[model samples]
Target chain A: MQLARKLAAKLVTGLVMIWVVATATFFLVLEMPGNPALAQEAADMQHGMSPAQAASATAVMFGFVPKQPLPDQYRHYLWQLLHFNLGVSIAEEGVPVSHIVASAAPWTVILASFGIIFSFLIGVTLGILTAIRRTTRLADGLTLLGAFINGVPVFVIAIMLVFVFATILAIFPQGGTVSVLETPGWNAGYLGSLVVHAVLPVACYTLAGLGAWQLTSKSSVITVLGDDFILAAELRGLRPLTLARYVARNAMLPLFTILAISFGLMFSGAVFIEEVFNYPGLGELLIASITTKDFPVLDGAFLLIIVAVILANILADLAYPLIDPRIRRS
Target chain B: MTRLARQPGPDPAGSAAAVEAAPDSVLAPDRGALGDGDAAVRVRDLTVSFPTADGPLPAVAGVSLDLARSHITGLVGESGSGKSTLALTLLNAVPPPGHVDGGSVTIEGVGDVLALHGADLRKMRGAEIGYVFQASQNSLNPLKPVGKQLLDLGRSHGERDQRVLLRRARALFDEMGMDAARVLASYQHELSGGMRQRVGIAFALLLNAHVVILDEPTTALDMLTQALVLEIIRKVHATRHLTTLVISHDVGVIGDLADRMAVMYAGRIVEEGPTVQVLAGPRHPYTRGLLTAMPRIAGDVSEARPLPGRPPDLASIPRQGCVFRPRCPLATRACAEAEPPVTVTGEHRFACFVAAQEVS
Candidate 1:
């Protein structure tokens, strides 16, 4: 019953966070220099409409009315969102924002999940090794390497990887999610090509994220190593495997919190990585919406990102008590 | 069991010689000569040192001690006096920044701990010796259930069957006077301080080790809890027939629980004898000072005078003289010229030039 209450509290907090983000995104997007109607006017003018014609067309586009009041617009947007309607995209003309978001969200989720998991696995392994062999020369060298990799920005690493593997070596494809000719499916050929295309972007994410996991795990392992329990375990004459398991399990507790926060971050944080690769992910969609002043699409993309973050945070909160028993008592 | 009265002034050399001739008179009544099986642990000339930036800092100088079987030998000293270091050496598991420089710790029926390595050392630690760390709460893995931690210790020591391990843990907790089911399900933090300490002791006991080393077991407990824990320790010591080394700065604790006691000063044993005899008529000045410093309820209401100076730094202890001479109230020119010789009277032995002579 207490667990249920704790979980309910977490869910409510997450929902409130998403609501706040939605409201803030609405106001921030609307407050941008040019309104969507004005952007529509500019686009129509570019298509050879006279200024008066473009203005009248935009007026008609708004249902023969000028812009609504801020409160009315907010109510309209919220009502539309309640009915699962994200409206039609202005930039892509007739494409529903929901459809666009649905297509792009999968790619982002897949890439970030793979990147985070693989980096976490590799980083934790290396981190445990370094912590165990802390004073050794090899561990010192690894520490220096981790610091170097962490210091460099993700985009820079992405660009450098592109230069080395794509441009200079001409080995992998430079950018894009998949080949234009191939049909998207679970079949071997399509999936293989998809993986090939994801290589660079995923590599960028992994390399960029590896350092934080390694550093965090290293510090955590070091801290647990100092714990008296560890000494007691050692004194008990536990074998190397048992000792390692005990140490690693305890050390991973702090990392769970980091993992939760990082999972939330990966949604929006993928923007630069997606842009660098031109991957058809939510990040690219958000960037495209911003450039063309597609407010509906922008709002939908922001909402998806914010919701992903909230959901990840909730999952973390739920998993915390399971991993750390002390939490359950309090 | 006539109580030996506290002696005043000095004794003649002839009496000291006569006492040394019949050493067993001061030995524990149940113990015979120091046979291989009689002494559960025998540490001889054990020296441990830490490597600092400047040079080697000796934490435990060449100190020797014998722990008789099924008896509690309390090693009492102020912090940094190498009490904890000496305890760690029993398992040959001195933590980093410190290493066993010289000496041998031999457990009867087990090989020399200092010389053993790899599997041999591990086996020795598993089957022969156990340790209870000073900080009781942190001495347990906070993330694991107490029972699971105990079970893991048992498993590593070759207890393979899960049911057997669980039963053993439950029995040990029961032995510790805790609710077996509740304690088994609880994490370290869920248990109170005293409970945690008892569980920590239970962890050590799970191995069924013949020798248990507890470092400052009652240092942080409330008076009642401390007394209870001490009682439990004494009971455990008696019931298990286990040679026990209890290290603490609390002389009162040692006085209460130990059958024999050794007082450490600046990395060396300053005084050692039967607990009652040593507390009643301490032969070494440092031991006398420690006894005086202890707060008493029955004595006159006088201020407890703490030892004046801090312990000598391990890095720069004087090499040519008695380490305690600088702080000694009875220090003379001879005390600074060389290390004091061990003076023996019956089972009691002390390292002091003046105290030995004056007391004798």
Candidate 2:
């Protein structure tokens, strides 16, 4: 009964978070300095319409209508959101914002999820080794490397990786998700090309994030090693493997919370990497919409990011009790 | 013959002649009383020290002690008196920065502990000498259930059958006076202090260790819990015929449970003897001071005196003379010039130029 109440409370909080993000995005997108009608007209003219014709078309679409109050616009947006409608993109003229978001999000999910998991595994293994062999020269060198990697910005690392792997080596594609001519499918050639294209951006994301996991895992394992329970385990003459299992299990608890929160942050934070790689992820769409003053697409993309983050957080909260039984009591 | 129990302090004038005759040979005779084969655990001239910015600080300084077979020997001292360090050295498990400088800790039929390394050392630890730490609460993994932790200890020592491990754990829990099923399911936080202590003892016994070292076992426990733990120790000692070393600061607890008692001060054993003999006629001033400070149920409470002056720092412990002299009430010029020779009377062994003479 208590668990049910706690879960219900979490569900309510998540909905409120989504609602707040939706409301904020709606107002913030609409309030941007550029005139949406003018931007739409300019975009139409670039697509081969005459300037006068594009201006008249933009006016027919929205220039004649009076702007609604913030509250009224919010209510309208919320209503559309409830009915699974994200409206049409003002900059793109006829494209539905929901359709744009749906197409872009899966690419971001695949890239970020794999990148984060790979980085986490590598970081944790190195962290454990460094912590166990703390006094050695190898541990010291690894620590220095982790600190150096962590100090550099993600975009800088991404650029460096691209320059080395794609620009110089010419081994992998320089940018984009897959070759333009290749069809998306489960077949080996298509999948291989997809993976080949993902290699640099994924490497960029993993390298940028690896240091944090290594530092957290190292510190947490160090703390667990100092615990009397560990000493007790040692006194019992436990096999090295058994001892490592006990240390790893206890040390990983704090990392679990960090992992969950970071997983959520990675989706939104993938913006820079996506932009750099020209990958068609939601982050790229969000950035493109911002530049074009595409209010509907901007709002839709922000809502999706917010929802994904909130869901990840809720999953983390639910997982905590399962991983750490002590949390279940409180 | 006069009993030293009622005497407030050693008589200075009478001790002069005996002090002159006292030599190292007098102390060496008592090693034969153990008959060479009787000592379950023998520690000779054990020295453990830690490295600091200043220099090496001796924590256990040239201390020799013997635990006779199937006896409960209580090591009583204040914190920093090196009792815990000495206890840990029995398993060759002294925490780093503090290493065995020089010592030979030998268990009969098991060879020298300090000489053993790796697997041989591990085999000796839980299998031969079980150690229960001072803080019972921290001694257990909070994440694991009691039964699983116990079984893990068993499994680590080559106990293969899960049924056998669980059955043995339950039986040990029952022996330690706990509800086996309930405790097996509960984690460390769920159990009370006394229950945790009993479980720790059970963990030690799971390996059927011959010499169990309980380091300050009842230090933080309440009166009732303390009594229960002491009773459990007593029962384990009696039933298992295990040679036990119970380390604590409480003289009363030691008095209640120990067959033999050794009093430590400044990393050295100042006095050691049969518990009754030591309590009745403590030959060393430090031992007498401890006995005098102990609160009795019917004593003049106002007369209970706390030992004056703090214990000396290990780094600058007097290299030439007795370590306890700075705090010794009976210290004379002779006590400061040279290290006091160990003096033995019957089975009682103590290091004091003045007190031993006065006792004789």
| lDDT tens digits by residue: candidate 1, B1-360 | 000121111222223334454443322221112433346677777889999887888899888787887789999998889998899889999889799888777666565777788978876675678888764448777788877777777778788888988887788778878899999888877888789888878878776777899889887788899888888898888887888999999898899889999999889988888898898889888998898887779776476777778777776677788898877898999899988867766667788878766755
Model 1 compared with the native: what TM-score? 0.91
TM per candidate comes to 0.91, 0.91
Model 2 interface root-mean-square deviation? 1.2
Q: Can you give the lDDT of residue A135 in candidate 2? A: 83
Clashes of each: 1, 0
lDDT of 2 by residue, B172-200 (tens): 88888889999999988888888888888
Cα displacement (Å) at residue B139, model 1: 2.0
Candidate 2 residue lDDT tens string, A84-146 = 888887777667888888899889988899889999999999999989988899999999998
Residue-level lDDT tens digits of model 1 in A1-330: 987897899888887887788899989998877677776788899999998888778755542222557898788888878788877777776678899999998899888989999899999888988898999999999998888999999889999999999999988899998887788888787888899999999989999989888988999999999988778878878877888888888899989888888888776878989999999898999899898888889999999878877888888888888898887767
TM-score attained by chain A of model 2: 0.91
